[model samples]
Target chain A: MVKKLRNYIGGSWVDSTATNFTPVVNPATCELLAECPDSPRADVDKAVKAAQEAYEEWRRTPVLSRAQYMYRFKNLLEERFEDLVEVVVKENGKTRDEARGEVRRGIESVDYAVSVPTVMRGYKVEDISSGIDETAERQPMGVFAAITPFNFPMMVPLWFLPTAITCGNTYIVKPSPQTPLSMELVYELLDELDLPEGVVNLVLGGKEASLAVMEHPGIVGVSFVGSTPVAKIVYETCAKHGKRVQAQGGAKNYIAVMPDANMEASVANIMGSAYGCAGQRCLAGSVVVAVGDAYEPLKNELVKRASGLRVGYGLSETTQMGTVISASAKERIESMIQMGVEEGAQPLLDGRGVKVEGFENGTFVGPTILDGVTPEMKVAREEIFGPVLSIMHVPDFDTAVEVINKSRYGNAASLFTSTGKYAREFKYRVNAGNIGINVGVAAATASFPFGGQKESFFGDLHGQGPDAIEFFTDRKILIERWL
Target chain B: MPSLNTFGAILTYAIEMESRLRDYYQAAGSEERARETDKRRSNLERVRRENVTEIKLEPIEGLDEADYALNLDDASAAGQQAAESTAARFYTDTAPKINVREVQRALERCAKQHAENASK
Candidate 1:
């Protein structure tokens, strides 16, 4: 049976009232996975109302109790870890192992939020004026909404929900219309957790739902993760509504290979970072600035490794990379590759027109490596968000850093070096939020703040860890004295 | 089979472990180092207090203190992290055997929290 996916609002599985629906496709086989509701503004209203109605009771529930619900949710997630991973693989088209990593990251967010008792703890100070006592407390900021992108339907919602809900704020999630089935399962599990009705709600759609979420008066805050253009829209709209927002934008993350770096390790890490998840992540190392003596050898090794990747269906054990999200995504990535070729960048290997066995209709884009890529090339500047690596050569570490710092995106930057001095200098000087000394994808763990700098991230506080607590709640101070 | 212990015994052991961690972080916090390290030590102290509060909720009962030993191998930041990790795993192992559902979950939550903090 084709699953009739619908919104989960006000403690019930509610169908979208709109007549039109979007077809959810399995990118691996170009198969129709499910029918996601093309949710309208009214659908957003219902979800937001549910969340706003549930906020008072949810916020009044003891923090420990809120954490207990998260524990239950986490247990459910672990018990069905493989099943959810399959959902991601089928719906989002990432390799099984990659899907597993994404699910683990989602689960890890729940695990971290289960520490809300500590994460949300406040402060006390006494004897300011011979008996004056002062205390500060953190309280939930009411209903919040998250607009998750298609590439990471499971992981991105988790990046917001677990933290927001555990901090005693109710949430409304608008999962990407193209990939809503996975979140359907997430809400199904949440249904069994006995949380207060409307504490967690789901609205499935694209722009309309997202815009409604941003403009809704009940939504005190908004969290979003997607491409830079939409992120800016959400940020601006939320700001106009006088709501708190954290919008994580796009990236052209760079990986610098220093002369002193180990060639073998750098090649391996770069291949994984650039090709893993079909290079559809904001933290993917799309550009490699190979400095001085490292350029030739590094390019050769990178090409060799990029050519060796096994591309097939995500469920296949031998498949190292999977399909992009949709047919349009495939076209977009391929067009970027062609643009690189036209711009005079040497095509080390072109992934365009690649076909996979058994899944002839699958949206596949094989690994592409472009050499002699200049910073002025559109492929080098924009986020291709695919299995494409652009290699640029520079004379020294300073030149490489200079080239990287010139880019508008500051999501992540990495340095591969054996010299501690050079590594430390690069880390300190890199104009990115997440930095890596010898790491490729310098993604922050659940326990640390994960965000970008400048255009990459808007707002002061980032998501995850202590920053999540700050984002979900507001701090209030009190002064009292007794006669 | 490993020796069985009461809820009080485990709680006491966890409290002792947190005390050792607190001492280690406090010493590290006082040392002249990078400002980031100072922030880390302060965060560790907060985690220590949180662990103590959760464990304190369990009822006291008869379980020998001799089986538990509080020791800190090192008083550095790395050492404190190791202690927190050990404590996290201890709670994870103890949770299933904990007869009360609420207490079991509390312990599990602490375990996951410390494990998270250890990585950070």
Candidate 2:
């Protein structure tokens, strides 16, 4: 019997008032792992009240003392790193290496938070006027909330929670119902901190609970990561309520391949970019624009190499590609591939027919490459969020950039080329927020902001690095002097 | 015999070996060798983390875990000697099969570490 998970409120695990519960299933094994409550509006209110009460004291704690908790937590996380990796694999269906990378990156966020005392320093300057001075200090707001996505359940929340708390803001997290177990484990670690109750809280639920948090007036800011349409809703809702918002949305990234690009290195990078994390990442390269004569051989090598990818359950060391999040995701990805085929694109390597030996019930999608894809096709324009790669041909480097910039999403764009002229030009004029030259996964580190432009992101500040500090705190200015 | 079908599987086997051998040396009298084993494990973990940044999807065909598997139940000096030789052979055998340049270099260094231990 799978136990239903609870909401951690006021430093205790309390059962939600919700009558509805969503099943948290392992995407690789199709096992019902746990039941996540569909928390009610009242439950969200209860969490807000707890966070608000804690914020009164946490905001007053010395900034250096607040950062001490972050460093200790980072050490605790390292000591138990592999255990968290196991939970991530069982809950999120990432392979051991992928789970390790996710957990490590999440820990890196805590590492970034450790610099709160330094980065959160106030700026003061002596004025030109006699005996006068001006000062600006970054101070924490009240309660903040994060509504994270299912694809990166653990990493995304860490990107917000640690940074927010280290800046002395109390936090409430509504982790996706599909993958709440990882955060539950994290909250268990946070519980050992011996801090005051309600400094950091967890609420597990579906849409109702998320909506409640978004609508709550007590929350000073709401950090969200999900689809574009829903991101717009979060942006509008937070704006209407006059709360600070950072809503990261969906993406359709393109990687242009010049004929002079290193075939061996480019193929390796392209494979990792298009298929890593089973192509669920926002920075995933979904479209390949091969310039002129680079199309045929690149297509052949991509098909041959991608066809050889070992697909199975994540725990298997031999398995390279894991499953999509759930059965519905697998179905949606297959239907998207079929739609591409119906629209005149050829299915060069179909993943729908691929299967693992023991995981017959798993939601697996192998490396899918769609050839002869056009710019206007649904597969080329839309975010499939699966292990599907669409290949298209362009006339030259200029045409490739035009095709890439025309997309509605501007999350990330990469160019595979040896020519400095094209690389420099592509980086300068690309519409995306992150540009990659001779690289595929152009993700920024925890010390840098990771968000998008255009329709891909809806706010000013992003989720990681200095942007997080800037997002959670506001600068107060002082202009006075006593002679 | 553990099946070593890919580079990930091979690294997993190596990690398991490091832990067992480190435990064996710590329980017996060789504290210095145990520390070396622990350091090697940490290095291999670093490799594991780096390799995942871009997983090499190519299947490794020829390596066998049976060629390097050790019987650590014995608690004598000969057992330690055999374990060191096995570790050396595991790295020497697996280095050529590695596709990634960093992994190959790390494996070479590991082989040298164990070879020095076996000689002493």
Candidate 3:
């Protein structure tokens, strides 16, 4: 049976205003899985209106009450976690394990949002001046919008919306058109918590829908995650419109393999960072900068590990890697691979034309590796957003740091080394927003703020952690005099 | 006669404007999602204004309406295709080209940076 696609507006599922329908395709089989309503301008308006109306009461809800709702939402997410993972894997084309990880990360955000009552508490000072007292409090920012990307459809939205709603702000989410179902399911889960109608809404559209959100006066703030180009646009437009904005963009994350680093551990970490989810993640380590003479060894190890990866449908229990999101991604990654080859980087492992058994119709790109990549190459500079890892050799630690710092993106970078001093120095010197030593993936926990720097992120509010609550809320200082 | 610097500046400005236009559309859509009631009218207005502005700002001369519309449509379709293709390829193939855990760790680093910034 085909699943019906609906927009969640004011806590209710409604059909699209337009007759047009977008078929949800399984990337693995190139088969139609379901259909989604092509959310028209009218549908977007209805959802937005519902959220605005709900905001009147939702914004007034007691912090403690909001906290209660968040707790319920968290429980609901956990309850539906397995189903959610399935949907994510099927629709998003991520491996089942990766889908589960995304869902778990999303649930963690909701769990953190549930603690808003404690996190949102204000600070009070007895006296600043004679007979004067001051107190500071956090307040909801009316209505807020979240523009999430296709990657981590569930987790990225939760990274912002949960905190926004829990902090007493109504939320409107424009999930990526590529993976709208996963987010729509999340909306349904949120609805079961019985939060006020219109407090949370989901609109599925493309640029037209996103522009509407940025231009609308009712939206007090906007949070977004996507490529750098789009993030820049979101940031500039919202800022120009006087709305608080946080838009994360692209990344060309680097993993610097130091001389003393354990070859096996580093290879394993690099394999996961570069190939997991086929490198669709915003924080994927696209560039591997090897310090000293470790480049050749690390490259060999990475290739060996890459070759051993079991690629299949995300639902396959034995599969370690899954297909890329769609057919076009395969083309792009292939093109980038071609570009890398043309740019003089030696192809260690060519993933192009890789065919999976039984899933021949699936959109699959093999894990690819390029060696002797220079900093000037497009493969090294641009965000490939694929499972193609480029290895650039650097003579010394300073050179590695320089190359990393020189990139336009500053999302994340890592160093695999045993020396504490070298690790500390690399962490301090790297221009990346996130840094790690011996660890490949450096994503922050729920308690830590998450964002990037330079072209990688375009706004003030980073998603999750303590900053998330603050992003969803505004600060108000109160002054009083008692004679 | 535009100098090299002037031409470069103009190119940069055009790129920036194109980015801003895309963002504005996204933000407007986000607004519609949040507000819901005035979605169609606002979206139409925003799209219309952006189209007009984009056309007016076009550096090429004598581009007709049909051509412009076709170009815009092509661009949009291309973007959608790109997104879908990228997603599809990543999900199907199993020759592990990149590592998932490492990517997560890298994302975590960004999260940590934000946390540190907040404390300050």
Candidate 4:
């Protein structure tokens, strides 16, 4: 039986006004796991109204009380933690360990939000003038909304929700219609807390629901994570609506392998980063700029490891790489591979038309490695968002940096080397927001903001850490003179 | 609950156990189980308050603050179950050796409650 999911609004499960429902499929087996409401603008308006009504008291609620809710919610999350991992695998098509890792990343955000009192503490100054005092308070913005992507249904929503709610702001989350079922389960966990009605809400739909969130007068801020095209629209719409906005877009992360680096470890890290989550994440390594003499050896080793990766269903404990999100996603990735081949990029390992033994209906895509890729190749420029790694060889470090800086994206970049001076230079000179010396993913922990630069990010303040508190609130200064 | 030789030590450990159980129940899903757990938590709170009052009224001899030190481990389900089981065993082993009649009765009842809750 395909389960039917409802939107959570005003502390209740609400059916959508739209008669049509969208089927949510498990990517691993292409099975319809549930049917999420193709919620219309009316549903969005109702949810926004509920959030607006709840905002008055929620914003006035003591910060400590809000923090207490996060604490309790965190406890509840940890108690049923395995269930979340299961959901991620069942719907998001990530391997078991990868799903667990995503859950841990989400928990880190909650853990950071638990320090709300300390993280959100405002500044105070005395004696600006004789017998004068000034204070600044970090106050909540009325209501906030988040539009997340399909790749990380569990972790990405948390990047916005806990911090926004902990800052005393009511919130509405519109998860990707592709992976809407997990957020429904998450709402059940939040409902267990002692929060007021409509403090947190979920609306499930596609573009119309997103348009509703962006245009809703009650929503004062917007946070989005998705493709660059959609993120640009979200940012522009939020700006037009006169709301605070943070729209983190897609990425084409690159890894530079130096000659002095550890080849074995670098190859292993490249394979994992390129194929992990089936390259669905924004931080997945899509390009590798092997410097000088390292190109031949690195390319050979990478192809060997990429070809050996086990591709099957995410639920299998032995499966190293899972399926792409959907059949369309698989088709898009294969077409991109064909584009690269036609564009003169050497296909060292072609994964086209690959099929698992029994799961023929699955949206599976094996890892593909392309060599002799150039900076001008379409495959190197655009984000394929699949298990395809393009290798572009450079003469030296300077040439590598030059080639990497040519791309329009500046999301994340990494270097594999043993030299301190070179690593320091790369760190200082890289144009990306997140950097790694010997790390593969370069994913920020909860203590720091996870964001990008240039076209990769659309706003000033990012999602996690202290930046989240700033993004969700405004500071008000108070000046007093005693008579 | 080891041979602490003081009513204050017993009360301190018992109070910690009750607090953990309360948190566990607050996160519980079933309405019936939640209500039952809430009642048990209230009973333990009342026992804690009575013991605290007694401690203030008549100071226990040979009592040290160090005896009540706590070691909070991981709060996962298995960890919490182990904690409850350990507390039940502590009360069961220490109740018979207590010289005070009221403290002995409280310890025995607390043991029975923890064991029952843990069995669920």
Return whichever of 2 and 4 wins on lDDT. 2
Off by over 4 Å in 3: A1-4, B1-120
Q: Stretches of candidate 4 above 4 Å error?
A: B1-120
Task: Give every collision pair in model 2.
Answer: none
Model 2, residue B71: distance off in Å is: 6.5
lDDT of 1 by residue, A202-253 (tens): 9988878888899999899999988888888888999999999999999999
TM-score of 2: 0.94
Give Cα distance to truth, residue A334, candidate 2, Å.
Answer: 0.3
What docking class should model 4 receive? incorrect
Model 1 TM-score, all chains together: 0.80
Instruction: Score every model by TM-score.
Output: 0.80, 0.94, 0.79, 0.80
* Candidate 4: tens digits of C-alpha lDDT, residues B49-120: 333211011112233324433334455666556656766776786666444466578778878876775676
Judged by whole-model lDDT over C-alpha atoms, candidate 1 comes out at 0.82
TM-score of model 4 relative to the true fold?
A: 0.80
DockQ of 3: 0.01
How much lDDT does candidate 2 score?
0.88
A157-238 per-residue lDDT for model 3 (tens digits): 8888888888888889888877888988888888788888899898877777789888887788999899999988998999
- State which candidate has the highest TM-score: 2
Write candidate 3's Cα lDDT for B1-120 as tens digits. Answer: 111111112222223323433454465453432232134234322232122110011111111222111122323534434422322232222112212333323223323432332243
Ten-residue segment with the worst summed lDDT in candidate 4 chain B? B52-61
Q: How does the DockQ of candidate 2 come out?
A: 0.37
DockQ of 4: 0.02
| DockQ per candidate | 0.02, 0.37, 0.01, 0.02
